[model samples]
Target: MAKRFFIKTFGCQMNVNDSEKMAGLLRDMGYEKAQTPEEADIVIVNTCSVRAKPDNKAYSFIGNLKRLKKRRPDLVVAVAGCVPQKEKEQILRFPHVDLVFGTFNFVKLPQLLERVKREGRVVEILNRKIPEEEKLPLVDSYLENPFIAYVTVQRGCNRFCTYCIVPFTRGRERSVAPHLVVEEVKRLAERGVKEVHLLGQNVDFYGYQGTDLADLLYMVSEVEGVERVRFTTSHPAGFSERIARAIRDIPKVCPYVHLPPQSGSNRVLERMNRGYTREEYIEKVQMLREFVPNVALSGDFIVGFPGETEEDFEQTLSLVEECVFDQAFVFEYSPRPFTKAATFKDDVPKEVKNRRLQTLQELVKKQALERNLERVGKVEEVLIEGFSPKGSELYGRTADNKPVAVEGSEELIGKTVEVEITQASPFFLKGKPVTTGVRSKR
Candidate 1:
């Protein structure tokens, strides 16, 4: 029987893409996918260390694998992703963990696994810089949805925000050549991918050999079969006017941007080493609105950082009211090892953090509902993704990336259609197809 493998992925889009790549590599090696870890001959856990919850979850899950390893001694258990990258020695201390690899050592998986079988335990963490010539070919795993694809335009991050661990885990920033990025998108388009989201720690900062993000956006938009393009996790400091103009001008580019402003107080912002003041972030938002009038803006916020006062929390609330963001990912601060902020006393009380998070979330929900309410009675072009979680309704996303549930057949899964918004909720919209058998433009 062919070896069966199971992978459980945790955290961001980048991790999801990494899991897909690993699955593809295993399939090429004549291994079949197992639906559950219990049934698999090899089980891999891809972890995240971005927050306390995900870190705790990874440890708990790996601990449970101890029994599975005992029941099936031949099982190859491995740990990969950011957590392993940061805690290499610590992770190997787990008795069941047979193989360990880091974020940059994904290409060395096969060799490491073979070495682990012979040596009983193996860890391969390479510190070598990712060269332009060694870029991995875009993995196409049809088994894991192919209609929507993520193309990594850049790797790593240069800006070391005090609270972030991306720099230590993923290393310094490196951009894939613009020509190669365009080629990847073209190949995805040929494979029936209607939408592509360019992935990077700071997407707007993408540039190499004088080709800026704006130039790359224009190139990708001109691809023949790609209907919509989006990018994520942009830093406010790196957002440029040229990139804003590109969003306004490119028909294929969606008018939504996820700019993260960790805090709204200048004092807190400076403490976090965000490189931009609260006033500058507001100015950037204004500039984006001026360029794209109908643009939907989303952002991230961290509450209860060390030394944050009631006044600082108030300023964050005030900024949210002023921005009236369509969506916001709010979090309570948690210190990570090796970050500058980790050295500071975690002065904020637990009760205070919980209260502040609740307040911010309530305001965000109200603003999101208000924004979605405006779409009522309007026709939106939606890319039909798939069925909703319960499979009782079909769902898709608008150009601004709002989820819209509509009445449609399974055949419309990969096609773009117009939906007339009838009702609005805080998280998504309800709609019906405007016309049948008429596909929207690319």
Candidate 2:
């Protein structure tokens, strides 16, 4: 039997894309995919440390593999990505962990695995980024969906928002060359990818050799055979008006933005070191709406930051109402190891946090339902992704990124179809296929 490998991933789309790169490298080494860790000759636990819960989950998983390591003895167990990047050699204290690599060290996997087997163990973390020529070649295969793909445009973050660990774990802002990013997109497009999401911790901070994200967007949208383009996790601080213009002008770009304002109170925002006031953040949103009227806006809200008062919580509620987000992700604050916020007193009472979270969530749901309802009578251009979980219907997202369930067949999986909205819910939209030539407003 061919040697097999298993990569268990956690957290964001970036980490999932990182796992794919590792899988492709293993495939080049003649390793096949293993369904379970127990059936694999190598097991990689690709971790995330963006939050306390996922951080702890990675440790728990590595611990459980202790018995498996004892039984297989030959199975090379490695922990890669953020948690390892943050924890470093400390993770190797887990005896069962044969190798530990950081986010930047993935390109060295084939050699690292061999060294781990010949030597006893290995721990490698690169403080500097590897060149694209070294990394992108290994990233060619193992795309989860051939029709839709994620290309990481940049890595790490420059914004040291007190509550975030990205700067420490992933290191500072490092952008792939714009030409390199475009080349990767062209390669994916050649292999039949229709849509691409440019991934980064803060895509707005993508600066390389005098080029910015807006420039990169124009480049990627020009790629031959590319149908849809999207980028995510933008910071409100430097979300330039030029970016707003690019979104407005670029027809191939998708009409959605995920900008996380973190909190709505200027006081809370300052304490979080977000750099932008509530007013400034809203101004950016206004600019986006001015450019793309039907553009969908989604955001992140931290309800119970340290020292967040009832008034501050209420301010967040007000922002949610004013922004009328297409979607919102509400998180109760949990301090991580390296964040400066962890040094402050986590003074918000647990019950108060829970109550505030529930309140904020209810408001978000109401806003989502209201926005989705507005689309009930509209026709949307949707990229048919695949069948629903039960395979009873087709599922896809509209140009504005609203989920739509249309009664269709497997044949429509990769086709872009027009759907007239029939019903709306807080989470998704229900619609049926329409044969009209109506263009999507978004």
Candidate 3:
């Protein structure tokens, strides 16, 4: 009988995509997916260490696995992704975990599993680039969603911002070969994926073989079946106007920008080593708006950093007021392991951090609703993804990167239809199907 396996994924889209790759690897090894962890021959917990809460959750889940391991000694328990990459062999402290590997070593899943099963326990964390000789796995059979796919264009971050652990965990930035990225997009297109969200730790820094992200953007857009292309997690410094121009010009490129300004206070930003000041960041935002007038601007903001003062927090509020972001993710500063900021005294009181977090979130909520409200009475092209969790409504996203829901059946899946925004909330927009096709771009 084929062994059964289940993967529990935690974290960003990158982790989700990684889990899919791992699933594909398992499938190649003749393992079928388990409906639940209780029946699986293998259980892989793909974890995220971006925040401390997920770390606790991952540990709690691992603790539960101990009981299952006792129940089935033959069952393989593994941990992967940022947590294992960060914790290294220390993760094996959980006696139930039979295998531990890092983000850089996922392509060797078949070999790793074989070694663990034969040798009892294994830990592999390569804190460096993938060796040139190691080839990526050709696995596409396990995508979580059928119509929307995440194509990782680049891996890691070169800019070690004081508060970020991405550089330490994911290693330095390396852009995938453009042709390879295009090939992946083509294959996904063949699978009926209409929306491709190019992913990176910092997408703007993508440069491989003398070609930048703009070149890759155009390359992917040229693929026949790709209807909408989007990229994410852009840092302010490397986001050039040329890329902005490409977003304006490319028919398939979506009109959304994720330029995270971690702090609005120049002093705090300098301490964080963000490489751009508040004014410089806002200038880029303005430039993006100029190039793509209908652009959906989204951002990430950190509140209650180590030395952040009330004045510093107020500056962040002012920045939010100025940006009026369509989406704003506000995070309370928690020093992550290996980040430079962790060495600094965490002087911000927990209560103060909570207050600041709430304040910023409320402001962002007001702005997001206001920005989404403006879209009311406008017709948007939406690529229907699938049903929402409730299963009562069909969900999709606009080219501008808005989550839109409308009354429709599953037949609309993968098709770009016109949606008229009728109502808006802080988190989502309700729309009605205005037409049944992609509208011509002006």
Off by over 4 Å in 2: 133-135, 138-141, 435-442
Query: What is candidate 2's local distance difference test score?
Result: 0.87
> For every model shown, what is its TM-score relative to the native structure?
0.96, 0.95, 0.96
Error of 1 at 260 (Å): 0.7
Residue-by-residue lDDT tens digits, candidate 2, 42-155: 999999999888888998999999999999899989999999888776687899899999888888899999898788889888888665632454333487666788888888
What is the C-alpha local distance difference test score of each model?
0.86, 0.87, 0.86
Give me candidate 1's TM-score against the actual structure. Answer: 0.96
Q: Count the backbone clashes (under 3 Å) in each candidate.
A: 0, 0, 0
**Model 1 local distance difference test score:** 0.86
Residue-level error in angstroms, candidate 1, position 53: 1.3
> Which pairs of residues clash in candidate 3, taking residues 3 or more apart in a chain or in different chains?
none
